[model samples]
Target: MASLSFVNVCKTYKNGLTVVKDFNLDIKDREFLILVGPSGCGKSMTLRMIAGLEDITSGELWIDGQLMNMTSPQSRDLSMVFQSYALYPHLTVYQNMAFGLKVHKVPKDEIEKRVGRAAEILHISHLLDRKPSALSGGQKQRVAIGSVIVRQPKAYLMDEPLSNLDAKLRSQMRVELAKIHRELGATIIYVTHDQVEAMTLGTRIVVMNSGVIQQAASPNDIYENPVNKFVAGFIGSPSMNFFPVWVARRGEKICLEFGKNKLIANEICSKRLVEDGYVGRRVYLGIRPEDFHEEGPEEQKILFDVEMKEVLGAEILFHGRINREEICVRLSPNVKAEPGERLPVYVDMDRIKLFDMDTEQNIIYV
Candidate 1:
């Protein structure tokens, strides 16, 4: 296993296209770190740089205490699994898995032993005589990974390896991949645009946008304590609701205002607002869909009517408009709701997020 670090890393093409900007991350040994974002976010580029498939334009990449700027792919001590299986159709499972060892001129008996073990671990031992053309999509991916496993590299680099599989297979494989990692104790850096995969498989997630990292944290931390609006909106399903809010003092208590709605702030946030000098300033209020409720006992709660309700399996999403801003609440699917009804909303004052109006950066105390 190896620890990886990207220090002030950058990637710029010859056409003057800057894909990555001052990217930095320190991945620990045997850590399953996931890089996630939309396309063209430089996630794949970062992986390529680590794999020695692409040269860095600037900065440094260190693996296991060694700088890997000019090292070739073979010397990087890494195995990569691509979106496409990249398997040799003509070669049987054993031959395909053993090919790398053969090229390195490992003894025939040793190659057979390694390949056999990999196939067994992957549960493809019975398919050793079968070619890629005869295997299922998930099976092909397993064979591809088995090929990598036989190499016994220091790390595994996976780039959207499940994109081609059906939903059910992908889900199954995600769990299997986690198990395989534990079994091998290998460091893995997986790149995917799928948030579900990123959330479920990673020990830590690094979310990138436009070649810049937006946030890096554990799944729960990333969801609950996003640093800014972008991270807050991007990390969750149904996303968080944002609206303009004005900070002020109402009578003896501190409060925030949104159009006709006004709610006294909790002690924790009131203290923070005063400390951050946000009193009497226009800011943004962020609340997640799941955080919204009908009503709760607190100093105050902002209520809004339901304009629409969507039943999605275990949760019902309430769509309501506040000051021309559309907001939603995820509640129990068992709740009875309807359109055109003014629903009383129970805002969780303690769970609310505050952001600076100017920079759109979260102002909540970390």
Candidate 2:
């Protein structure tokens, strides 16, 4: 296994359009790191740069201990699994898995041993003789991964390898991929647009937007303590509810006022806001869908007319509007509520997030 580093790396076109800017990261050996963001966010480009498939306009790329800014793709000693799977339709799974080694003149017996081990690890040992044309989407994906595993590269680069699979298959593949990582103890750098994949498979995730990294941290930190509004809103499924609230002081306590409703701020939040001189300023109040409670005293409640309800088996998502801004609340599936019905919702004040109205940066952490 080998560690990788990107030091002030950048990519720019001749037209002066920069797709990646001053990107820097250190990936530990045997770590599963995921780079995630929306489309056109430069994640794929960054992966390609690491693989030597894209040129770094500036800065250095290092693998293990050596600088590899000018290294060729085949000389990088890394394996990349593309979104397309890139399987050879004319070759059987066994031949496809053996192709890389065969080109390097690995002994026939050694080649068979490596391929067999990889196939067993991926649970595709029985499909070795079948051609790509005869394989299912999930099966073909495994074969692609198996081919890379046989080479025993220093690190694995996966670019949305499960994007083509159906939703159910993608979920199953995520589990399988996690198991594969454990079995091999390999260093992997995976890029994807799926937050679920990032949250579930990554030991650490890098969230990117517009060629800049929004945050790089463990899944829990990224979800619960996002550095900015973009990171908080991007990492969660239902996103976060942002309300334009007024900060006010009442006696020794601070409160956030939303329309006619008021939520008492916690001690920490109050101190920070008072010290920052935001007692009468407007800020964005962020609350996750799951943080809204239905069981609270009337004084703590904020009434909303339910606009819609989505039944998602274990939970019911109630969609509503507050001052023309949309908000969603995730409740127990057994909770009875319907559209056009009025519901009183309370927020977990301690779990709420506060962001600067002008900068959109988390003020609580600042």
Candidate 3:
């Protein structure tokens, strides 16, 4: 419902500790923007700054074209949902959902209408008369979200609101939150350490690390074309595998060499390596777990000494050594494999990524 812009925002505490550095981002109206990283990466601090809960040490925060540096939390027209479902334990679901509206002295009929609509949207209409102690974890979370929805704020700020739920419930709520976003058309700024949540929920994801914005883009772009090694390693589930290899030229062909193994570089990678003068230099070779295949060209195959295996329903994860470097490979469950076995696996050369050894930046993308 509103656009938010952070222009060179930085937050430093009195102890001289800076958690967010030179942060700049523009959140579009009706956009589900996610701020995601490891703990202490300044994602929550950024969200708090937007809610006027934290003071901006420097730079500007503009909400819908108005400077809101000194605005109070209540005056900011933003609602925040925390990890802990901060519900009035003694109050019924209906009362908890209606509390904010009643505080503003909204008409009795209007409060009922808003609460009813929110309850229906959250699929918690049947539990309206129940108190917090009587509802399940998922139900209580829905009530917490329902409370915020009734406010009809300009944007919703969520700081890992689903983190408290169990794994199964968390999965269920992810779907619900996506549905709510579509129905309300509300602008939401969500902060989380869970990359899965960031990938599934956000229309755009901002990957941060140690106070800096690493990469901000659509989920597909960030996954397929990461700006650097940190973003690439952090966004994926199994994490991308990296190997330090020398870029070598065998006449017209370019290859990545590590230990006794070699992978022929694709045409694009070969040209970049040659033109960039990386031949015979060491760089990090990145490959996702899914990129390894059980079959391929004989020359492209490498020996994988499997040390461990994980059978995850539809797929199996082989953890072992390839070219003397530890790596993980995801394969269909239809394939049979066991520990202490040496298997030949092929890598998808076109999907491999090369990173500068010193800077750890993706060569092709950066």
* C-alpha lDDT values of all predictions: 0.89, 0.92, 0.93
| Per-candidate TM-score against the hidden true structure | 0.94, 0.98, 0.98
Q: Write the per-residue lDDT of candidate 3 for residues 1-366, one digit (tens) a residue.
A: 799999999999999999999999999999999999999999999999999999999999999999999999989888888888889999999999999888888999999999999999999999999999999889989999999999999999998999989999999999999999999999999999999999999999999999999999999999999999999899897999999999998877998988888889999999888888899899999999999898999767878899999999988999999767889999888878789999788999989889989898888994
Looking at model 1, residue 291 earns an lDDT score of 82
Highest-scoring model, lDDT: 3
Task: Compute the lDDT for candidate 3.
Answer: 0.93
RMSD of 2: 1.2
RMSD for each of the candidates: 1.9, 1.2, 1.1
TM-score comparison, 1 vs 3, better candidate: 3
Per-residue alpha-carbon lDDT of candidate 1 for residues 266-365, written as tens digits (9 for 90 to 100):
8888888888999999999998888877667654566677888888898889898887899998888767778877766678888988889988888874
Q: Which 10 residues in a row give candidate 1 its minimum summed lDDT?
A: 294-303
Instruction: Give the C-alpha miss distance for residue 48 in model 1, angstroms.
Output: 0.6
Candidate 2 residues 176-243, lDDT tens each? 89998998999999999999999999999999999998899999999999998899899999999899
